[model samples]
Target: MWHIYQFPLCPFSRKVRLLMAEKGIAYELQSARPWEGEDRFFAMNPAGCTPVIKDPDRNIVLSDSRAICEYFEETVDRNPQISGTAQQRAEIRRLVAMFDENFFRDVSGPLLHERMKKRLVLRQSPDAKALREAMKLAHDYLDYVDWLIDNRPWLAGSTMSLADLTAAAQISVADYLGGIDWTTHEQARAWYLVMKSRPSFQPLLSERMEVIQPPSHYAEVDA
Candidate 1:
């Protein structure tokens, strides 16, 4: 069986989960908190990150979300290939990086760490100034997304790819924190609604962290 170590709220973990589901790959999910530095998990990945997948069938383990996804693209042959031609795939990679790196660093990391992580792990109050800045960044990023998807069928191009999954992963967490105001961006909201309604995304929408309740509209596709 494929074993996946993950954190429920982690975007990287969510990205892997969505990809696996999209590919119809079955795996057992094990929740892990890398921040606490668990010994066995650290052994699997010294970098100490969630979303590590151990494919017992192949007798190999992998770390890093992008590496794992790329490995899947290279090894797994399935319908609706996630990666396209070399040049198209490069654009997809670029957009994925935009979300995973730029969006995460500027918006998801700061806002989530302040609003969710600090309260859950550190047992401290959120830094209001940090949250304000993160929220500002989030709005700017949302406007960019609106423009990017204004014409294309997906974030990267005509087909749905890792770029869409990456952005969705981050947006899911933001929605959980009641951070996204979807009404402001009509095209982005339309795109997100389609994403949210997918079977792969349903389980993620239903996940509720202990002591933290998502907004009423979180799992509602039409909302």
Candidate 2:
């Protein structure tokens, strides 16, 4: 069996998990918290990141989530067209990059590091300045998503792709922490509702932190 080294809450890890579930691939989940500095974790991934995949053959040690997703797409039998044709693949890559870069940097990263600090049980107090900055950045990011959803059902295009999963994973974390104000971005909110309703998304919605409870409508598909 393939062994997936992951933390339940990490967005990147969540993306890989979602893909695995979508493809109906059975794998063993090895819980590893990179923040704790495990030697084995470091051995698997020098960067000490979560979501590393260890193939049973021990020949392939995949680190990056995108690379792992691509690997699975190429090697697996079901739904092997995650990237589609060369042109479509390029677009998927671009949107996946956007989610990892722009969305994570300007939205989820700050929300977790700032607004959700209290819930995450950090040693430091919530930084008001950082919270304000993150809120502004998140709102702007949502505005862009709003525009995208207005034009297309998915972030990259019509069909559900890795791009949607990547963005959904990050946004789901924020939503879990109650960091989003969905009322402000109706289009984005609607799109998210659809994604959140998927069976693949159920695991994320049910995920609970020690101190954090998801919003009341989190488990509601039509909410």
Candidate 3:
């Protein structure tokens, strides 16, 4: 069985888990915190990142969320998340990068540092100003999502793709940290509800991080 080294709240790991579940790939979770700087995890991934997958039976090791997902997309061949015409695939990849890099940089990363890392590791209270700034950026990102939903059935195109999963992954983390306000973004909220109700998303919603708790609406699919 493939063993995934990840913590409960790592969005990148969550994205990989979602793809694996959608593709019916079986995996066992081995909770890891890269911030602790464990030598074993670093050996698997010199970058000291979570979401490293290893198959001891085959002695295969892989790291990096996008690379791991693409590896499965190529090897598993059951559910194709990056499928479509070449142009369509390009669009999907573009959106994935936007969510994974840009969205994380502006929204998810800040919330994680202020809300999660600060409270859990640094023993420091969250910065109200930083949290407010991140939440405001979230609104802008959600407005963009609203526009996308108004144009296409899904983020990238007519059907669901990695773009949708990638965006949802970041949003899920942000939401868990109480950084998301669904008010005034009806289209985006509706689309996110659909994502939350998916089978692959249920497990993620139910899992909890160490001490921090999500807002009440975080796990409620209809809320």
Candidate number of the best lDDT = 3
Ranking by TM-score: 3, 1, 2
Q: How much is the lDDT of residue 58 in candidate 1?
A: 83
lDDT, candidates in the order shown: 0.86, 0.79, 0.94
Q: Residue 185 of model 2: what lDDT?
A: 97
Using TM-score as the measure, which candidate wins? 3
Candidate 1 residue-wise lDDT, 81-123, digit = tens: 3667889988999988999999899888886788778988999
Over the stretch 1-223, how does candidate 3's per-residue lDDT look in tens digits? 9999998889899999999999999999998989999888899999888799999899999999999988999998887899999999999999999999999999999999999999888999999999999999999999999999999999999999999999999999999999999999999999999999999999999999987899999999988
Order the numbered candidates by lDDT, best leading: 3, 1, 2
Q: For all the candidates, what are their Cα RMSDs to the real structure?
A: 1.3, 2.1, 0.7
C-alpha lDDT (0 to 100) for residue 98 of candidate 3: 96
With a 3 Å backbone cut-off (N, CA, C), the pairs that clash in candidate 3 are none
Which residue pairs clash in candidate 1?
Answer: none
Q: Where does candidate 2 stray beyond 4 Å?
A: 57-59, 115-122
- Models 1 onward score TM values of 0.95, 0.90, 0.98
